[model samples]
Target: MLPLVHNELYVEFNDEKQGPFYPAEGPIPFGKFRKHKKSSVELKADRIGELAKTISLPRSALSGINGSDQALLAQANIVQMEKPKSMPFDDSPFLQSTTFKNKLDAKTAIADYLGKPLSRLTDLQIVAINMILDETLDKKTVMDKIRAYFTLSSAGHSGGD
Candidate 1:
């Protein structure tokens, strides 16, 4: 979701397994966006996919809770509903990770695989580019080849776990 905002103009529908899309180009990697500072929370590896569920028990679900417990629950509700403050863009791993290179090498390779030129891509066609890159980086595999097989296969198909 971090990279999604930067390339929003061109790749509004990135499929994550690939990268953003340009209407003229198709799925490509994180290209050189005019503005490119992306911000995201860095959760520990141990907490990667853990969903924030069952963190607090509902008043109805707990029969023995007293008035103080109910007050605490109300306070918790307020905190949970408040919009979360975002961290600084420089805090993102993309700035330091080897997988998050800013150069167009990966983007060019992805464009070649998709049979499209980078500049020709419009503000549409690409979908979920960040997700694709994130998943690819996690797997330690080749980015272009991975994108090639998926783009050559079918529309709406994803290689993500």
Candidate 2:
């Protein structure tokens, strides 16, 4: 039977109706559900993809690895990419010592378009705003870029434009 309020399809199992099932999906594990987690190899593959984006790895080197776990580990070791030192809640020492606030304040047009005082913006927001604030870009362009940035960020995309 079609759900009236929620358009989810229900499965009829053993003369009983099971709901909230979608096409192309398996039966819900219900109480037996263990949260799906990526295995270590999958995690390492993800890390390799991320690191490859940041650093210029030779095609030959990547191909030579042939998806071996040891090779992937060796490549990761070669890059030496350390994770960021702190969480979002913790203040960044670099931002703390830098003059981004003063720079943002000095630009009245950019500040006005943002619709917030420098003090009101978070460090990440300030960084995004600063990154796109080229003298060539108008206030609307700047704001649009910043909007797109936050949208991508909220959608879980990371790294530069």
Candidate 3:
């Protein structure tokens, strides 16, 4: 519900999936807005696809509750509203793994094939090398893919090997 304008109560409508829309321009009175779907909360996976209910308590609703209970309820509501934070990117797992060694070997091989230092390789060249290396880092496989990429890049075609 929005603030009263000239003693008339106003309310806003918002659809979770489509977001809020202004019908007849801005907030309408509760009676003026048509109700659909009856307003239900749906629990879904992290990805979008269902309606999520927002837990909000108006000041009047919380006024009657005892301080301790109100604090607990507020904490619980906050927990429900917050999304879990993800761990930042880290390479510790591959620091000394065989996959790490293979990646290094692949990078070196690509640099050698292109007759350039690894740091001197362009972003596109590095990405092309990594794309092939991701499939299989065998020397022959890497060489063949790099050759294909080189051919395409030289032929005025790009982005695909």
Identify the candidate with maximal lDDT.
Answer: 3
Which is better, 1 or 2, measured by lDDT?
2
User: Which segments of candidate 2 are over 4 A away from where they belong?
Assistant: 1-107, 151-161
Point out the worst 10-residue segment of candidate 2 by lDDT: 97-106
> What TM-score goes with each of the models?
0.23, 0.25, 0.33
- Tell me the number of clashing residue pairs for each predicted model: 14, 0, 0
Task: List ranges where model 3 is wrong by over 4 Å.
Answer: 1-101, 157-161
- Candidate 1 least-lDDT 10 residues: 4-13
lDDT per residue for candidate 1 within 1-161, as digits (tens), equals 45643433432335535445445544556865554434455344325546544267767667665777669989888533556899767766665555535435556566776677755543433444444554564323546545664565455546442
How well is each residue in 131-157 modelled by candidate 3, as lDDT tens digits? 888888676666777888887777986
Q: Which candidate is the best by TM-score?
A: 3
Instruction: For residue 123, give model 1's deviation from the true position in Å.
Output: 7.1
Predictions ranked by TM-score, top down?
3, 2, 1
Query: RMSD for each model, in Å, please?
Result: 30.6, 21.7, 20.1
Candidate 3, residue 157: lDDT: 63
lDDT of each: 0.53, 0.64, 0.65
